[model samples]
Target chain A: MQIIIDPYSWLLGLAGGLLIGLSAALLLIGSGRIAGISGIAGNLLFERGPDRGWRALFVLGLILAPLIVGWLRPELRAAAPTVNAGMIVVAGLLVGFGTRLGSGCTSGHGICGISRLSPRSLLATATFMAAGFVTVYLIRHLPGLA
Target chain B: MKNLIGLLAGLLFGAGLTIGGMVQPQKVLGFLDLAGVWDPSLAFVMGGGLLVAFPAFALARRRDRPLFDLAFQIPTRNDIDKRLIVGAVLFGVGWGIAGYCPGPAIAALSALHPATLLFCVAMVAGMWLQRRLMR
Candidate 1:
């Protein structure tokens, strides 16, 4: 609970967040979409309608951007995967199912929804954040629980 | 046209996530660990995003329709329900546990880590399972 001095780069975080916001804006203005990644990914997997084409392309772009960037600057790429496989699988399942049932993820509810000032999104964001905080508290503080 | 726009938006979004450091589980966990040495970078990311998105969405609200699409396709339901709350709680727990939200996990795929690949597969399977259970 105590605030330790942050060592990470806030400037980098802000720059990245701007890009995310720009992407959402572009999607909204150009295609009338919300740029909700989970919704897009989920629909791409299950839907077979006319919307599938764009969804596929969008996901492809998401996958390729890092590869392209890494090719240009390898240092910018994500570090090696460190989380254990068991935790990864459980977390992935929960994320996938939860986002679907909830109809949004961090991007959907956190970025786009919150910016629009939707009450539902505000509440959802608060709920999830609280839940995340509590979960982390349990895992890190409650020895032997994690 | 819409496909091209989708690709562009996706690229920007993915790149932003990478640049913002959301792709790292350790960093994300640090942000989530309020009881520990909390990294406030995630808050900055959200703040920056809101700064841009707020005006952009406001502009969109004033428009009649999108440039490519005939209508602005967005969620209409406003009723807060149990499903939304429960699902979000579950997602938060999972995020806290593994530090990979949907976007960062997908974007992290370029790293080609086997665990990332496995996580993506499990995530898709989870999505499928949710639909099946609901059906």
Candidate 2:
């Protein structure tokens, strides 16, 4: 397997990952909650409780952080994806359904759950990551899929 | 104060995703497409998150409740069940297809891209459908 090597991106990835970890850590310490983005965002729609405000605020911050960055660092402005919009919407729907059914996503299970050594999250993370790998293979290799 | 912490967490998480380049579909797709021009950057990003989180969770186990809250909301179930696997499979396929999971998608909503907006709408609809039909 050919490894794509780029030191700059590696540095960014590690820094970003640490930040993500720290954010989860903060949430855990402050509210005793996992920073699974899907669960936090989904709750805004399906569940109603006094706890909704924090979740909403968390989501709002997630949505707006990039804008704030763009305002501060014009050079770090986000680049737009060029994929077909219809396909993206379908993917989004599937992701939404799957995450709700699965009970978490990358953040919840991948980072927090795995770090805490939760068995369910571990299984879920393995399954999803494998599925992701397989899906990418099929999408890229299969004649009709790509 | 609790909500403020929540907001800070969100802000930091979003910034991490941005800086980590998780917000870009191409970057994510590169990471997933192992057979293609594979990108291992995301692995580093996830690793970075885990590195800091490990000790924090260690600290978490010592506390019965959060500092600003009355109780902890950590998951307690240990069972690896069908729902978890099947749901994850579906979610993975979707993530592979779009390169935008829930977090980045939400973050990208700030960009006001039309298709992503459609995806978010559809995602919410799918979530609603799951609530109505899956239970």
Query: Which candidate number maximizes TM-score?
Result: 2
Error of 2 at B27 (Å): 0.5
Candidate 1 segments whose C-alpha is farther than 4 A from its true place: A1-8
At residue A122, candidate 1 shows an lDDT of: 88
Candidate 1 local lDDT, A30-114, one digit each (tens): 9889989999999988988988988888888888887776777666686534667888888889989989988899999999999
Q: For residues A1-146, what per-residue lDDT tens digits would candidate 2 score against the true structure?
A: 57899999999899989999999999999988899988988888889998799999999889889888767766555554566877777788889999999999999999999999998998999998999889889988889877
Q: Which stretches of candidate 2 lie over 4 Å from their true place?
A: A73-76, A79-81
TM-scores for chain B, listed for all candidates: 0.97, 0.97
The numbered model that scores best in lDDT is 2
Interface RMSD of 1: 1.3
Model 2 iRMSD vs. native: 1.2
Candidate 1, B7-111: lDDT as tens digits: 898898888888788888888888999888888888888988898899989999999999998999988888999989999998898888888889988998888
TM-score of chain A, cand. 1: 0.88
RMSD of each: 1.6, 1.3
True contacts kept of each: 0.78, 0.81
